[model samples]
Target: MQALAGFLWWAAVFLSPVVREATLGNLDPVAVAVFDIPLFVVASAVAAFGVKAAALVSAGWTGAVAVALAIYATVTTEAGWGVLGMGAATAGSLIALCLVLLGRVPTAWIIRGPFAFRPAIPRPTAASHVASTFGQIVLFWGFFLAAIPFAVAFLEGRWAVVLLFPSFAAPVGVAVLILASALGISAAVAMSTLGNGTPLPSAMPNHLVIAGPYRWIRNPMAAAGILQGAAVGVILQSWLVVAYAVVGSLVWNYVVRPLEEADLEERFGEEFRQYRDAVRCWVPRGSKTLRSQKP
Candidate 1:
C-alpha cells in the first residue's frame, strides 16, 4: 500500500506539467531517464521506509496531502491531468489506509498473511541454500529481464506502442531494474552476512536473521523479486506480467510457505513458530524493541 502510494505520488510529480516543462522542455526524456536512474534506487528505499512506517503516520499525512491538493485544484480550477492523477493517488492512499487499519487489505494475500522464514538443515544445508539462492535468482531474473525484449518485440510488431517507450515505459522499466537489483542484493547480503546462511533451506542459517532489511520485513528477498515482476507489468501495461506476479504470490502463499514452515518447524521446533507469530512476514511490524543478533 505504501509502496503504491509513494510510486503514484512520484508519478504525479513526474507527469506534472511544471516538472515536464522545467526538465523535459524540448528535451528527450531518455537523457533525463539516464541521469535519473539513481533516483529510482533511492525511491525504493523511500518506499520501504514508508511502508514500514505507514501504519503509524499514513492517515495524518495522507489527509494533509489530500487537503493541500484539493486547495490547489480549487485554486487552479482547470482540472488538469495532474490534479486528476493526484486525486487518484489520494483516494487510493486513503482507501489503503482504511483497509490496513481494518486488517482487510485486498493485498493481504500477497503480503504478510502467509509467509515465514525457516532454517532447517537435515544435511549439507549451506551449499544447498547457496545453490537454491542462485537458482532462485536465475529463475526470477531470467523471466523478469526477458520481459524487456519481449515487450519491445510484441508491442512493436502488434500495435506499434512506440510512443510508450521513452515517455512511459522505459523509465518505469529501468526503475524496476534498479529497485529489484538493490532489494535482491540486499536480501542475499543480509542472509549471508547476518544469518550465516544462504537463501535456500538446504543451507539454512545457523542463526535467525533479523538484521539488515530483515530488520524490517521477513521475506525481503522474495518480496523483492515478486514486487519487481509486478513493477514490470505496471510499466509495460501488460496483464501477462501482472498475472505472473499474482500467480506467483499465490504460489508463495499457498504452496511454498506451508512446505517451508514445516521444514522450519522440523528444524527449529518452537523457535520458528514463535518468531513467525511474533513478526509479520512481509508488511513490517516495525520497531522491534530488542536489537538483532550482532554480526
Candidate 2:
C-alpha cells in the first residue's frame, strides 16, 4: 500500500502541470519537471524498497512541496479548478506521507506508548464522570464543530475559495445534527453509568460497555462524532469542513482504533472479542441480531 500510494503521488505530481495548463490556460511543465519530479521519484523509490528512514524523509518532503504548491495556487490563481486540483495533489502527498509513517512505526505505539490510557484510581464518582463528559462535549463541539468550521470559512474567504451550500440542505443538516447528537449523548451516558468511566481515553471505562448504542455498534461515539462533524459542515456549507471531518474519521479508524481495541483485548480478553465479533464498528446491527447477541 505504501508503494502504491508513493507511485500514485508521483503520478499525480507528474501530471499536475498538464492539469494546471488545461484548467488555468497556463503552461509551466518545466517547473514541475525541475522541482517535483525528481523528489517524488526518490520518494517512490525509497518507499518501494522499504527504506523506512529515507522513505519518511522523502515522503515528508513531497508532502511539504505539495502543500506549498497548493497554498500558492490558492492565493495566486483565479482558476477554481486549478486550486482544487492542487488541493487533491496535496491530499495525496499527505496520505502517502502518512502511509510511510504508519509503515515505519508499530501500530500499538501510536495509542499506547505516549498517550496510554491511565485508569482512574479509586474510581471516579458519578459527578466526576458527568463533569468530565460535559467538559469533553464542550471542547469537542466548541472547538471541532464550531470554531474549526468558522476558521476554515475565514481562510476560504481570504483565499477567495468560498463555496456555499444550497438553501435546501439546511433542514437535512439540522436533522442529521439532532440525530447524531442524540446518539453521542446516549453512548456517553452508557459509558459513564454502565462501564464506570468517561469517554476520554485518559479516564476510560472500567468494564466493557455493550449496552445502549454499544449493543448494536462497537463505536457509537466515534460514529456519532464523525456524523456530527459532517452535519456541521453541511450547516456551515463548507466542503473543506466536510473534508476535515472525513480526514478525522480516517485518523481515528486507522490510528486510534487499533490502540483502543488492543487495550481492550489486553484487559477484557474474551469478552471484548465476543462483543467485537458481534457488533459492527460504525454501522448499527439490526434489532434481530441485537436480540440474539449477549452483552
Candidate 3:
C-alpha cells in the first residue's frame, strides 16, 4: 500500500502539467517537470526498495508538497477543477505519508517514549471521574465537533464550495448523535462506578471493566465517539469533516488501541485476554452469547 501510494503521488505530479492546462488554461509546466518530476521519482524509487530513511524522507517531502499545492489552490487559483485537482493531490500525498510512516516505523517506537500510555497511580474518586468526564466532553464537542468543522467550512468556502445536507440526513444525524451520546455516557458511568476511573489514559480505570456496554463491545466509548463525529459531519454535510472524523478513528484504532490493549493485558493478564478474545472491539455481539461466555 505504501508503494502504491508513492506511485500514485508520483503519477499525480507527473500529470500536473496536463491537469493545470485543462483546468486553469495554458500555464508553464516546465518548472514541475524539471524539479518535481525528478525529485518524486527518485524518492518514490528509493522508498519502494524498503529503505526506512528514504521512506521517511519521501513522506516528509510529499506532505510538504501537498500542503504547498493546497495553499496555492485555495488562495491563488480561482478554477474549481484546479482546486479539485489540488485536493486529490493533497489526499494522495497524505495517504502516501501515512502509509510510509506506518509501514517503516516500529510500533514500539511509535507508542513508547513521550507517547507511552501511563495509567494514573492511586485511582481517582467518583467525584474526580465525573469532573474529568465532563471536561473531556466539553473539549471534544467544542474543539473537534464545533471548532474544527467551522474551520473546514471556512476553508471550503474560499474555493466557492457550498455543502448542504438533505432534509432526511438531519434527522438521521440527530438520531445517531443521540444514540452515540447515550452509549458514551453509559460507558463513562461504567468506567467510573465499576472500574473506578476516568476515560483519560492518565486517569484510566484500575480494574478491568466488563460491565454495561463492555459486556457487548470492547470499546464502546471509542465507537460512540467516532459515531458522534460522523453524525456531526452528516448533519453539517461536510465531506472534509466526515473525512476528518474517519481519519481520527483510524489513528485511534491503529495507533492508540494496541498500546491500550497492551497495557490492559500487562495489568490484568488472563482476565483481559479472555475478555478481549470473547468480545469484538467495535461491533456488539448477541447478549445471550456474550453473557454466556463472560470472562
Candidate 4:
C-alpha cells in the first residue's frame, strides 16, 4: 500500500506538468515551479517520520522539481537551454537527496552555516566490524572527492564520451531511474537499520544487518552505488567511470565489506550467527524469515 502511494505520487510529479500543459495549452514555468515547491516541502516533512515515507517523499520532491523545471523551461524559453539547466540540477540533486535518504550512507548537513557531522552508527556485531576501517575511510571519502568531477561533468559540460553505456539513456529516463533506485535503496537501508540496528529508528546502528535486501543479496547499498554510478557514467560517458564501476563493485564485495561483516560477527557472537543462519548472506533462498530468531 505504501509503495503504491509512493509510485502514484512520483507518477503525478512527472505527469502533472504535462497534464497542465495539455489542459491549459500554455502556462508559465515559474508559476509551475512556485506551485511545486510547496509539494516537496510538505512531502519532506512527512517523510521524516519513517524510512519508506522518506523514500517516497524524496521521489515525490525530485519528480516535482524536475517536471516543474521542464514546464518552466517549455513555457518561458526554448526547450533546449531550459532542459540543459534543469537536467544538470536534477542529476546532481538526485545523487544528493538519494544519499541523504539512505541513512547508512553518511552525509553532513549545514547547521548555522557550518557543516555538522551526522555519521552512521557503527555495527555492534562481528559481521559489521571486519571491513578495515581504513577501507571505509578511503571509499566514502573517495566518494566525496569523486562527486566533484561527477557533478562537473554531468552538469557544466557535455563530455561527448557519455554516449556509450547501456544503462545510460535519455535525460528523462536517466532521471527517473536514478530517483527510483534511490528510493529502493533507501527502503533497503531502512529495513536493515530497523531490523539490525536499534529499536528506535533514530537511535543508532546497533548490530549487523542480514535481512531484507541482505536476505536476497549481500549488499543492496552497493547495488545502489552501481546504479547511481552507472547513471553518472552514462551521463559523462567517461571510460574511466565505466572502469571505476567494475573495479569498485568487485572491491567493495570481495575486499572491503567482508572485513566489516567479520568484525560484526566477532562483536555479536552467537547472536550474529543465529541471524546469519536464518538469513542468506546475499541470497533469499527460502521462504523463512529471521523473525523467529533468539534474541
Candidate 5:
C-alpha cells in the first residue's frame, strides 16, 4: 500500500508540468509541485506515527487529491479528464494489488525504509548483495538521471525533443561527472569487498565499512551522488537539478539516517553504535588509521 502511494506520487511527479499544462493551462507550477513528492512524503511521515486512523486519513487525502485533480482536468482541458481517470484507475489498481501482496507476506519481511529488521527473510548471498547495489545504481544513474532531461522537455510540451544527456558546459560537466562516478563506484566497491554487502539496507553492509573512501566520510556514496547531481546541474545549466540534489541530501539527513542508525543498532548492536559515535554521517572526522577486519 505504501509502495503504491509512493509510485502514484512518483508518477505524478514524472508526468509533472506536462500534466499540469495540458489540464490546467495557466495554473502555477508551484501549486502542483506542492502535491508532488512532498505531499506523499508528508503522508508517509504521518503514517510513520503508527496510528492507523491517521494513516487512513492520509490515504483518504491522497485519494481526494486524485479526485480533485480529475475534477480540475474535467473543467480545464478537452481530453484531460480521460487522462486523469486512467491515471487514477491505474494508481488505484496498483494500490489494491500491493495490499493483497502485503497481506500474504509476513510483516517481518516488509521493508519500510533504509533500515529495518527482516526476520522472515534470509540474509543475502554475496552475489545478491553486489547485484542489488548495482541495480540501485542503475536506477539512480541510468533511469532517474537519464529520465530528467526528457522529463523537462515534456514539462515544456516538447516531447518530440527528448534529451538524455546533460549539455551546456560539456567539458567541465564531463570532468565533474567522471570524478563523482569514480568516488561513488569506489565506495560501493569498498562496501561490497570490505563490508561483505551492499550500501542498501536490504543488503546492508555486514561489517562496519571504515575502509577506502569510507575512511574519509561515513557516507561517501551519498556525497558522490550529490556531487554528481551538482555536476549534472552545472552541465545542463539547470538549478532544478541542483535543488533536487539538495533536497535529496536533506531527506537522507533528516529522515533516512536516524532510522538507519536505529536499525544498525538493532542488528550489529553496540558495534554500530560505537562506529556511529566515532564517525560522522556526512563530514569526515580527523584522519586516523587502524588495521581493518574483513568480516
Candidate 6:
C-alpha cells in the first residue's frame, strides 16, 4: 500500500511538463527521448536515499520516474516510442540501483541500534531469507549492470505477452521463461522462511519472527524465491533465467544451507541441532511441531 501510494505520487512529479518543456525546448522527439534517458537516470539515482524510511520509498521514486516517462510519451507528438523506451530504462535502472545501495548500506544508518525507522523494526527477520537474499543479489546485479539488455528485450515486446496468454502462440517462448523465473523466486523465498532472517548477531536486537509464513515452511522465503525466479523467466522469456533458477537452487540446497547449518550448530549448539532434527530442513515436517525437543 505504501509502495503504491509513493509510486503514484512521485510518478506525477516525473511526468510534469514543467520538466519537459523547460529542458527539451521543442527538440525532435528522438532527440528529446535520447536526452530524457540520462536525466531520469540521474534524477532517480540522486533522490534515492532513505533505507531507514521504508522499502517503498525507493520503489515509489523509481515507479514515479517510469510513469513520468510514459506520460510524457503519450502527450508528446511523435515521441511515443521514445517516451516508453526511456520510461522502461528509468524504471529498470532506478530499481536496480536503489536495491544495490540498500543491500550494501550499513545497518547502523537504517537503525539507531534498535529503533528501526524504515522497515520499522531495525533488522527484523524478513519472512523469507532464501527469497530475500536471492532477490537482493539479483536486483543488485540485474538492476545495476544488466539493465540495458533487459530494457531492450522488454521494449521489443519479448515477454510482455506472457501476461496474457492462451491467446497463445504469440510468443510462447517468453511465457515459459516467466513461469520458470517465478518458480525459482518462490523456492528461494520459501527456503529463507525456514529461519526468519538468518538469526542475526545476538548483539543486534530485533524482532524474532515465529509466525505467519515462518511457521509453516521453515523457509517460505526460499520457496518465494523459486517463484520469483520462475516469474522473471516467464516475464523475460529468457533461457538464461531458467539456468539461473536451476543452478541457484542447487547451490542453495547443497552449499548455502549446509554452511548456514554449520553456523547455527556452532551458535545454538544442541538446541539448534534439536530444532534441525524436528524441523525438516527445507520443507515443513508439518504442524504441532516443536522448536526444540530434548531428544
| Best-matching candidate per lDDT | 2
Q: Judging by lDDT, tell me the better candidate of 1 and 5.
A: 5
Candidate 3, 1-295: lDDT as tens digits = 4445435644554477654443343334556546555455466667666566665665566556556655754675434444555455445544555566675335455655545666545544666766777788788778887898878766666654556767798789889999998999888888776676778776777778888899898999999988888888887777667777899899889978988998999989999998998888998777444443222
**lDDT per residue (tens digit) for residues 1-295 in model 6:** 2233334433443586643343232544356335333344334444454443333444454466456554544354323343443445545555445565565423243234543322222334554444445656577447622474365444434212123334343356456445545544544444345334432222211223334444555445555555455445445654445445666677667655665456556656786665566666556757556642110
TM-score of each: 0.47, 0.76, 0.78, 0.39, 0.56, 0.35
Per-residue error for 167 in candidate 2, Å, reads 2.7
Overall local distance difference test of candidate 6: 0.45
Report the C-alpha lDDT of model 4 over 1-295, residue by residue, as the tens digit: 3333334544554578753343223545456546444444444444445546554555656566566655554444423233443344444445445555665433222111322212246565523423333244346535732674375454323322233545535474469446746644553454434444431223223545554455555556566665566556555655545446666677667655665556556766897777666755444567766553123
Per-residue error (Å), model 1, residue 29: 48
Per-residue lDDT of model 2, residues 1-295, tens digit only: 4445445644654577654453343435456556545566555566556556656665566567556655664566534444555455555555555566664445555556436776644354666776778788889789988998888765565455667778988789889999999999988987877676788877888888888888888999999989998998888787877888999999899888988888899989998888888888887667435443232
Per-model root-mean-square deviation over C-alphas: 15.8, 4.5, 4.4, 18.4, 10.4, 14.6
Better of 3 and 6 by lDDT: 3
**How many clashes in each structure?**
4, 0, 0, 25, 0, 69
Candidate 3 regions with alpha-carbon error over 4 angstroms:
1-18, 21-27, 50-57, 77-103, 109-115, 160-165, 287-295
The alpha-carbon lDDT assigned to residue 285 of candidate 5 equals: 73
The stretch of ten residues in a row with the least summed lDDT in candidate 5 is 153-162
Q: Please identify model 2 stretches exceeding 4 Å from their true place.
A: 1-18, 21-29, 41-47, 50-57, 77-105, 112-114, 157-164, 287-295
lDDT of residue 155 for candidate 1: 37
> Model 3: how far is 224 from its true place, Å?
0.7
Give the best candidate by TM-score.
3
Candidate 2 TM-score, C-alpha based: 0.76
Q: What is the lDDT of residue 45 in candidate 1?
A: 37
- Kindly list the per-residue Cα lDDT of model 5 for residues 1-295, writing each as its tens digit: 5535555644664477665455445656457556644545455455455544444545565566666655554455433433444355445433433444353323333346544543212344556666767887998787556677434323322212113544546678779899999999988888876676777666677677777887667788988888787777666665556556777788677666666667778878877666667777778777654345453
What C-alpha lDDT values do all the predictions have? 0.57, 0.71, 0.69, 0.48, 0.60, 0.45
Say which prediction, candidate 2 or candidate 4, comes out ahead on lDDT.
Answer: 2
